[model samples]
Target: MLRRTGIPLLALAVFAGPALAGCGGGEPEESAADLLSRAKTTLDDASSAHFVLDSEGAPNSGTLLVGGEGDIARPASFEGTLNVRALGSTLDLEVVSVDGTVYAQLPFASGFSVVDPAQFGFGDPGALLDPDTGISQLLAEAENAELGEERRVDGDVVREVTAELPGDLVEQILASQDPSQAVQARFSIATETGELRRAELTGPFFTAEDDATYTVELSDFGADVEITAPPTG
Candidate 1:
């Protein structure tokens, strides 16, 4: 009788183990809004970061930004190269911004020259990390945000959040041809660190007739970076 009772108890324990594991014994999953809030805070607290911006389907004839990669420091400072489509060709311009003034080494130019950022169809890349006017604003203003799949990015687990953004707000961060049209955005935030890993935007950014997609990747948060104005001749 003792042996028979022990067998039954062992069977019960084996069955219960799988049930407990299936019930998700870990912490509860975070809501989409809560995750975005945490990501915003993470970026807001970061002093500097590295970024890569790439766009697709942009018109070839206009003075529009095609791609860029560089480092940005807090309180408005940036150093990087920008790919701009102008005069029917793409020009890679070396740019540096400090305190609202933009300096660029124009193609075939001898030295850096002060120029208007708007001429290239985008504003100060340095402002991309601003807590109030930059990426944080998009997180706070996202409408109907919904959590999507989780995936590994650069060896880190990230969660995707899908949402719609106001076109005017997007226009402020990047350039847009139609500020009245809404833009779709997908944000990938690191699950462990709550840091924004990537942002994908799709909308009529270059022209009202065609839609363009821009992918921005952020990393190296809180990096010790210092940017200064280039010597202009």
Candidate 2:
């Protein structure tokens, strides 16, 4: 079983005030919005990063192993396991989204298949952090943004921020609500490096469930990221 995400998944403390600079960076004081915008720019310009998305106990779940690790990159594709809790089974699923198309190795299959990620509860995981309409856009459109206190996350001290996300992005990425429904979002960034560490969205995504939290953690920024369709026999 995958390890739990730990206690850092607290609801980001949202204070009603101007943003503040992160905990340690010896830089000009910046509001939560400024910091987020800067970080978004940094990530948008990067080629790739090792990513791990954990949504167990969430409305949707899944994955794969690279040397026994679940590592995926952005801008085009993701390879990992797809967790099916209802059936208590997991499938090796790889997804690629580029040029308005999605390719994948569906569960219980070996060859690459053209598929839609929306069927898996995500419109497109590859674009979840898109420079334009993904997290970058959300941060740019964030409102009531506030910087929270610094805290340790997975052993590293990170600066936290909480804000309200645009309704459209919430519907697109989390999809826990109707397009018109609004939601809150929180993010943590490395104080020293301004790197985004974690993102949490709290809202309703599943049927009959009032509200659920989906957390996505990112690491290994700027690692080699290469994606290609599976080989045809």
Candidate 3:
């Protein structure tokens, strides 16, 4: 049993630093729409990036660490380690998407199995930002957005923005093949470069008594990386 109340993900921002004004800008800064729009443009322009995802609470009820470098464009692919929570161990997992097909490297009797994507908790990794219902589109759908304190992270000023998300937006970010919950996300962006540093998403995707939260950290934004298909056994 858990309390219905817990620290909202944004609460982490308070520890950033003394409250400070927005980042220095001569253009009076842009609206969330414009800023995110440009950031989306930047992300869309990128061919690949390295990413890590940490999530917990109701739905999973266990800690999960999944990360790897992959292409951001359609036919997305990623090679990384997925800690086998049940076994209390970690294993290498490779995910690939070419055209519209998505597949994963699963375990098969001391060997590896190239199976469908569903078993790995993903419906379509490549379409996560499909320009229609992707993260960029989710930000485009953001409402009640308010800027929060600006603080320095690794010497770069990061700005926080909170907003309520529509159901579809919430589901789209889910790591599972199934997602049917309304969501809200706290966004952290780089003030100087308009780069998205982190995103914390909260939603009621688990059950009535509990909620789900996903913390996604995106880094190495424009690294040149190629995630190709694994060898056939």
Candidate 4:
């Protein structure tokens, strides 16, 4: 999944850093469940917001712009536009899907493609930005969440947290991380605002078919944004 759609899925694993960072840690803080509750409360108060995601790889980096509306899980929808420059080439993936059909647009492409709604699952940029799905849920569930330790991502500081993501939630988190049974990923929430700051899943690097690490950081909120999907695809 990660290899086939490297540009799109990259956001799933590495985009939560800013939100989690907003949930800075200091000392003993709230419980995991408490943190999730508080984070949801804060999210409920937001009608709309912006997010910026950066993914780091050897010798290069990628950026994504995500805009979300409505509440996590029940969000009317979301839009994500990703710009990536790596290996001496630039690629852009623009996705917006609300209702049923999904729209996908790419750089150097004449136009967008209308495809089956299923194609846009977590693998697509639309679901990647939706609160009910992908990293959005992880961030919204971050209230009262605990912390583990601090780590470095793209030269930035990040903290760890642990919690259970049941049912569909489990699928979303796992899809983003691309974890195997050998790898154990611990999900965590922020202590200050109960936001999901960091989730660490450790195993072997470059061993999975995905050819990427199973870790991710999500962050950067309230940025300039615009997202629109074709009515039908």
Winning model by lDDT: 1
Give the higher-TM-score candidate: 3 or 4: 3
Instruction: Point to the candidate with the largest TM-score.
Output: 1
Model 4 lDDT vs. the true structure? Answer: 0.45
Please give, for residues 1-233, the per-residue lDDT of candidate 1 as tens digits.
99989998999999998998888777788999999999999999999999999999987687999899999889888999998999889889999999889999988899999999998888988787888788788898999999999999999999999999999999999978899999999999999999999999999999987889999999999999999898999
TM-score of each: 0.91, 0.73, 0.71, 0.48
Better-scoring candidate (lDDT), 2 or 4: 2
Worst 10 residues of 1 by lDDT: 126-135
Candidate 3 overall lDDT versus native: 0.60
lDDT of 4 by residue, 130-232 (tens): 5565555755543334556655544554345554333235344433323332333455444444444445544323223432334444444333344455653
C-alpha lDDT of residue 67 in model 4: 21
lDDT of 2 by residue, 101-220 (tens): 666676567677777666655666556556775656766777899999899877788888999876666776556555455667789988767778887766665542455566667777
How good is model 3 by TM-score?
0.71
Off by more than 4 A, model 3: 1-27, 58-75, 83-92, 108-112, 175-181
* Candidate 3 colliding pairs: none
lDDT of 1 at 10: 100
Ranking by TM-score: 1, 2, 3, 4
Superior by lDDT: candidate 1 or candidate 3: 1
C-alpha lDDT of all candidate models, in order? 0.92, 0.63, 0.60, 0.45
The digit string of per-residue lDDT tens for model 3 on 142-219 reads 788878768876778888888877765565555422355457788888877877777788766544446667777777
